[model samples]
Target chain A: MSPLSLTHRDTVAGPVLLVAGELDFVHAAELRRQVEGLVLHAGQCLVLDLSGVEFCDSTGITALLAARQHALAAEAEIVLAAVPAHLERILTIVGLVQVFTLRATAEDT
Target chain B: MGCARRVPADLNASPGPTTGPGLRSAPGAGDAGAPVGETWRHAPYPVLVADRRGVLTGLNEAARQYLPRAARGDRLRDLAPSWLAEAHHRLAEARSPGGGDVPAGHLGDRFFEAHPTPAGDGRVVWWLIDRTDALQAETALHSARTRSEMLSGIASTLLSTLNVPRCMEVTASLAAQHLAEGAVLIAPPQGRRHQLTYAARGTGAVQVTQQVDTRSVPGLAEALQGFPPVPARWLNPDDIPDWLIPEGFTGPVGSVIVTPLPGHGVPAGALVLLRSGTEKAFTEGEEAFARLFAARAGAALSAARLYAEQSAITATLMRELLPPKLGSVHGVEYAGNYRAATDQERIGGDFYDVHPGSDPSRETLVVLGDVAGKGLDAAVLTGKIRNTLQALLPLADDHQRVLSLLNGALLSSHQTRFATLVLASVRRGDEGVHLRLTSGGHLPPLIIRADGTVEEAPTHGTLVGALPQVRARTIETVLAPGEICLLYTDGITEARGGPLGEELFGEERLRRALAGCAGMPAEAVVEHVQMLAFQWLRSGGHDDMAVVAIGAARSGGPPTVAGAKDGMNL
Candidate 1:
């Protein structure tokens, strides 16, 4: 069980949250809290950078959906940047790929 | 003249000795019928008599010491350069018939109250009294009130949430905003040490520990010892540990207050508050307030830690209760899924397993059963039954004998628990896949023919576990290529709640559901039935559901039985 590490930075676009390690049940709530604290305005974007993510589970997927919902509620945009291949497969299987914007890197967003 | 004294030509002459409470009289001036002029000259308070022209006419000993440069006839403007202009304006107001006492004013650092009284012959008396001590007391009272209000705010914010990480986040945010310029909460090491540093941002706080050291910091060690808040001031950069400094933090931290957060029996962690250059050091009052805040945070952390531990334990047990993955078996397509009726923390008694036989016949044994109860008790019984069946798998050829042995084992245990289970033995020969099923008070298996026909397999037996001896009969059938069989728990057929809101998803309804699933793969067959059952039970209650579907290999497909082994002694 690899421990999760979260780091965040503010950019002209909005806030970008970087997640690493295994994003599973144990550390899903922490990511949720960090994302929930973000204050977004219309036309701003919140990007989740997951290039370093080693693994993700159903709970992790749920947290990502929650982040999307929060951004939508705030009338803002959300993008998943650098998502690992395995997580993308799961997202596609669960039919959530259509609901989120994907980018190859944070710079791309 | 009738006057007791005349004005002296030389005003600088020393005149009087103090000899009264309000007025000090000169040594000989205390005599009976002493002149009123001598008494007024030695008054204890500063007294200045200015004529209607605002010129100083007379002043006592106290006035000379307090003002230092005034002569009897000097103008008020020449003596007190800073205050005389304001005094002249105030004097004009005082001479008015309706004028009141002047408000207090500062003379240098000291405060004073000025009282003016009208006198005859164009002379006015002014008295000045010091008020420095009273002003100091008022300022101190106001500061104490502000500190306490901040303490209350910190307490309410820390105690508002019970989540452990959120509690720590709030603590860091509030401490940084109200108590210090930078704050870090060092949680008790979880596998490895890490710090959560929150620095004050515009209206919120940001986490800044991207590359922190995992080792315990110096102050944190002392804090974990359970001492009170320890204040460190004028600390050199070397004195501060590497873990406490956030990556890219450029500000110099001059001081810090580190306090222990005591949990149920031990300290949960430590909270470190940092201040930069020129910020006032932590006062005793603030340290007391920090302790109050940490106490509330400690309780919330302890509760959350305990909950996490219990959840971990439940997850471990559930993993144990879950049936092993149903791997591919020879000549059959196997798929199954189970959903517990309760939350994730609980284990349901609904279980199923497929064990291939060890003999040359290559027969495979499949079992699906539900214990009589729910929760831990049922789970324990299910484990026992599964273990016993694993030991009895060598007898797979004699289905009735294996069940009779299971029945005897349960009765001999003297336990009140019972179970309903279906046991099937499957083998492949030149004809097709052969299946023999035996039911011990369990539901009959549903067989779907390749031609879209669905019907219950003809198998029936007595219930197990209550009687000393039991009898069960076996029904054998051959599934041609593309045909499938499904065995399920009562949770499916007995489920209630449909369009009518009170009807059971009876066996007839299950048959109707399978009618449309012909020629489908085994996995899709199980999914279709499970989905229909779920839809029927929507808006109502359900029990645990478990299903296992076995299909014969298609005719043209390569044989799935090559090198296949037997019985997974589960």
Candidate 2:
């Protein structure tokens, strides 16, 4: 029952939002707001660091959609980093894992 | 209220001010005769005229049918039945001379809009238009708006729930608030009896906290005892026993809509919307809204279920990749722990495995590795490495040779692009226990002694598939009795802690944990180490960890591949 939390650190690649905690309906809007505030430049990459995330529900998925929209609106790209096993499975089942570029961490190619 | 106006037959009738002896017919009917006079009576409404003496002067065919009495010569005071005469008098006093058309009274479930226009002198023409359709349309529109608002509120409520049951309750209550009364009953039958649960509206005096068994209501049981549930609207009021109407449901009411809540396939339960007052009956529009909301509620339920199912599946899949329990060899006992990350969505590719090697009579092959990514990509890579390792065991007893084979397979195959791996095999039987190990950019295994000391097994090998000419080296060691050994993923070594990044649990913490638990049984040793790992991370051990613990079950026991079998995998 650790409070679900997410943190974003701006890297050379647009921004890297490291999310930890339950990304379910309760906190999804907060995550979306943070994503919305990101300044996406053309050709930049918005990396969603999910290494610390424990749970992600449909609302969380929608937040990711919002983040993707923010990036695409600016003609930028978005990627996922350190996606947890459970979240990855869900993303895969829903065919989202394929849509987003995934890396092990910031270091992984 | 005024003198009656006799509209001449030849004059063009006014568009709106419908008048004459033809205006007092039935409410919905319009005149169908006499060109000029017909137009006046056919002005899309019923017009009635009454003079100052309250004498009924004109009865248009259209206006004649709507009233109980349309006799031309009768006085208005006597023509209408007693009840209606009093109502008309009240209406006349309330009518404004220039108020235009407005609603007057409700009669027999119908609403009336009365428009009174003064004629020459003191006569008045009362134009009555049936407004039930317009009022009903307006009410329906309001109901739809209310339903949408309730749905939006439910969506907001769903956002805060993590526990599935609480989410379901919220969804059910949201649906209930828009249906039936301010309370709703959800009943799912189990075996011979149905378990009924109720949720009340956001604000109401009625507390919907009751369980009604099938036996308690004979009608409900009979309705349920069919292929498809008997619709509540079709149930005769006489057929329903008095006790079944719940607490507030009294006497005969409007139609009760019994819509069965569809399950995955079959009908799971019923949504009964009982209409009480005549005005409270469910319209088709309301029923459609209920169905739409029900579909959304079902989707939410399905989502919760999918989450749980995937969680269980992920745990199972992670377990499947781990080695089974191993028997004691010499004096060594073996055990291991595998955690597949905290993500509830996908199964990770981190895996550990143990099996027989080329020298079947003497050794057991043990492999541990973490796929570069997660989910299916990582899982597929793990699978490839695992299958290759298993296939190579019978072909090579040398650790470097086995590692070389894995590298070649990874480089040649399109399945697993690349991976980090550790392959180790231990000799069993009288020759003591000889450990042969190789690493492919994988975390090195740790050897713990009986004297409370720890060392990283000195073996560094090229990462598998990184290059075509990647050559790996093998390190050999002989383990004595009453000793412990640990092999794991970098998830353990990379854990961060302490103030200002001062405490790196790294190898030191792991060494201490192993040494402390060295004297315990193998499984207990694994658990103790795992507990330390969890504690060190302070956060459910970020990133999945695969731990293999090999120790002596009793004193003076040698560690062997048989022991490594249980320790190396999972």
Candidate 3:
């Protein structure tokens, strides 16, 4: 039920976006817009720190995939840092556990 | 009717009491206090005595004060108001009083009705009585009547329809013909564009939509935003933008009024009225009346807008949310039922469709799914998913490939939604019936045997549309006569109800219900399952629940099973 908030921070891993709150139908497009607006050079890594994701639905899953697609099109690497436990189970249920690079924490990226 | 040229007797009657004869040089030698003819000299009302030649002979003290220019021997034309002098000439020539309106005119700032009485020596005594207050009262009464009639007409005409465009048209026309020489109605801007309905006196309104700079007109942008309008006097007529002028209107604007149309809670729109330079400038009273009119129009327009919006949503619901009817396919009986989450929530994420194959030999495809979210958005996506599945019927035998293709289609589209789907391909032959069931993150279908036991198919996969790939395992099973295979969405098991109104109608309850319906017909099986789930949630919680049962009709001969059931929940 929490509203979504996104914050961008430049890190050694390149650009890291801290995403908090529910990533459902209403807020998924906002997340996609934020990701698409980022300038990712080749070989740079874009990390999504989802440590605060409260609720993730199928639309939220699609948004994550769209972000990954955007990064790949820029020839940049994408990673999910600090994935919430429920979101991890969701990713596994959709057979997407092996698709993206995962890190234990944003600092690990 | 009285002759127009006749002067009525009342016009001849002296406006005041005639000089009392008793006062004229003592009627009985000692009864009078004034001398002979002194009453004419001291009449209380203005009295002018003019001869047939239109030359003033004498005047009373009141006349001197009322007509300051009058001299003892001056001509009536040079001393008195022209209307009075003209009346004196006309009345002096007539011997008897005629029948017609009396002459009236303005003398300085005061209004008067002049009465005449015959005097000796071919002269007329003119009495001027002030009637300024009476005339003003009558005029005000007439203007008030006219305004009330117009307001009532506006009310009836505005309430006549719920069509927004028609209402706007009427608003523009009424304001143009009644309130001003021309009118321009600006609807609330949608995005950066504005819709304008323009009307001129004696012309039908025309509508145009374009991006307009609201700031071009003074007080326009604020008025459009529901702010109170600035006084019309503050507006400079020359500053009006070209777009503001009604088409074909070829007159200079004398005055302009921009006012907000107050609606329910929010402003409906803004109204602009234009007056030609030849016409009188708008008055403060007129501006206040315009606001009253704008209020009525605003209420009606907003109501119409709301009605339009609601109907559009309903149309979408009717076209896409209603589940399709299921019937017998080939030799198998197919029946399905759907229920929305609540009365207000007529549509939710749950949806299902059964597509009969091109031929009797080909398997009929049944797809059931639940999209993310609920209501209108989810129902819309459900429609797309069903369409995609129908297009991939040729690949029904390969459930994994069908899901992957659908995934690609959904991902490529602009919708940010995904769905879980279970596809069932059915083929009937000399054997009872064959069904290949596949689950794409949807719960596996439950099979009912003639022996009254329920077995869950060993099939599961990732949901379609959201993931980069789809992986599913398809299980083949055969239904021996009078056996049913039930496919349903999560709404059935996820319904929160029972004692505390928080308990879920879980899978165990569903499996038990199916076992009780073993050996039943397809229609009966689905009805029984749905009825139980619906009853369990009678305490209140519900979601969009759907159940599709594909059953093989019982035969006269012994049943031949194509293969034994492969999966079991136990």
Candidate 4:
């Protein structure tokens, strides 16, 4: 299954990619490709809704890093929504959590 | 003659005749010469002369009268029966200065006693007396001795055995010995029928044993079917149907006595004795003994059954209440350990649940909690709380709302019980990840980053079921890639670390550990944090713990906050 699932909802958060499966070695490239396909632009914020992901291995982690780099290159920002407790711990320990802007829900965006 | 007088001179020399020679009548000198007619009439201590060879040489008038012989000499040995002659010879040999009574001969209804006196001639004076009364007394004395000995032998045989069948066998043998011609049969009750348990005979006959139902042995049934059952006896031959009587049972079976074994419950069987026509029926005392035996047997059987049943129940209950292994969740391996208290009847109070997240897209939802007490009651409450959470998870919007709903669901019953719970939902995003944490008076979640660093996630709510007015704690954190999170029960933190209960690897210690583990993946992060928890406690944690970890990729840039510049990230 594709790690990156694109879903659009007419909510205040705008177009969202609800990543519903694990972004691991099995599907990280697919996730990276989906992020690269997004129409990035300056001033626009890409919302990555992660409520569906059950796991995020190192490979998935790298794909996520690539998504951020892509968005940065386009001068556009990225928002990580519905971050799970396990992933938050990894970020905090690595001091990378301070770099991510996380919210409880996409609506919070 | 005087009672103690010495008789004539000749009499002392020759006492009794060898063949009763002296027992002859006196012969008066017949007139002058013509052959005197032998006067053989009176024999009073008859005087006759016999030689040592038992030849009679002469006879006086009394001798002639006692023997009626005209000849002057006769051989006495040929004149009497051998037994009589032998008696006389024995008397002669026994003779001494003081004479002893001698057996002369046996007569109808009489025994003779003879005394002898020697005379000048080769003769002896023999006096005989009858001893009928003494003999009769002796016979009677011998009969009584035999009966006493038989009774003692019977008693010993009865007491020597412990086996029921052996005892029964001995009983039958004793009966045959004393009663003479009858066989002994013991029919024990077998369900609705009476089965012949034992039968024996000294006659070397194979005893026929027939099975008799209660219907066939009605008289026996009636007597035994009573409280403190008694052995019943049937004496009428007609009472037993001919077909039911064991084969080879012949003669007038004058009577059959069926004695029920006396016992607490129905007798195992009755002891039925078949008396032959030639033998007398069983007396009342024998029936009483059979009943006593049955009573003792019944007690043994009941005791054995009771012991078996009690132990079986105890073992069954233990197996049912204790679990062998914990449930495993995919992507979230779970380990549960439980120990029962020393209290025999108490059940465990720890519980846990792993369910699919309410949002199909979210990470696994895991909850582990414990009731406040230890017992069946606590266990029941634990089950209730676990079941309620499982039921609500699929529909509940967030981890916090699930706890609130559970608290509400238990408000009434919670009047007496309290529980600690931790609920966690894991999700991954492109930049990092998402987690919604809630605590219900439970231990905070342990978050382990890929760098081997650890932190206890803060819970912002009160213990579930603690109060009617309580809100759940909700915290949101986005995990950068390569970090892990753990949610556990207080069994890990409050675990005593030192003698004074002073050493505790509290939240800070756990945070440091998780920080060290931040370099590993989610699975390894969980394992390392648990290892530290165990090491801090110096053993397995003291109570139940549930750990849930979520990790994400690394990004040098800050995780994008949704509408970061627009809305406050509540």
Expressed as tens digits, the lDDT of each residue in B272-325 for candidate 2 is: 555555446666666676666555554555456557668788778756554455
Better of 1 and 3 by TM-score: 1
Q: Write the per-residue lDDT of candidate 4 for residues B1-570, one digit (tens) a residue.
A: 002222324333344432223332223221112232233223343444444456555556643443464354566566533444555455455443133324344533345444444443324444443334444554556545664565555555555544445555555555444543444444444454443433334443233345555556545565445334333344466766654344444576665655454434544344455667775655654444434433443333233334455668856754554433323222223333444332354345655655643232446565666665556666677778877877886754577677778888887775525676677665545555666777665656666655565556666555566455555557777666666666654444444454444465555666666677665755565566566666666542244333445445453333233322321111
Off by over 4 Å in 3: A1-109, B1-317, B340-346, B414-416, B538-542, B555-570
For each of the candidates, what fraction of the native contacts does it recover? 0.00, 0.00, 0.40, 0.00
TM-score of 3: 0.51
Q: Can you list each candidate's DockQ? A: 0.01, 0.02, 0.20, 0.01
Q: After superposition, how far is residue A16 of candidate 1 from its true place, in Å?
A: 75
How high is each candidate's TM-score? 0.60, 0.50, 0.51, 0.37
Candidate no. 1 TM-score: 0.60
Task: Give per-residue CA lDDT, model 1, range A40-107, as digits (tens).
Answer: 88889999999988766434765786788788889999999998887775455333555679999987
The numbered model that scores best in lDDT is 3
**Fraction of the native A-B contacts that model 4 recovers:** 0.00
Docking class of 4: incorrect
Candidate 3 per-residue C-alpha lDDT over B1-570 given as tens digits, one digit per residue, 9 for 90 to 100: 111233334333425343222222322223222222445666577877777788887888788887777787899988777777777767767743333466778877887777665554566666666666766766677787888899889989998989999999999999998999899999999988989999999899999999999899888889888898766753566799889999857677778999888777888889999988888888987898898899999999999899999999887766676788887656678898888766776677888888776555668888888887667777777878888888888888898899989989987873446788788998887777888998887777899998889999888788777656778888999998899999988678766676666666777888988888888899998888888777778767566788899989885432123221211001
- Model 1: clashing residue pairs? B355-B567, B356-B566, B356-B567, B357-B567
Chain A TM-scores of all predicted models: 0.95, 0.92, 0.96, 0.83
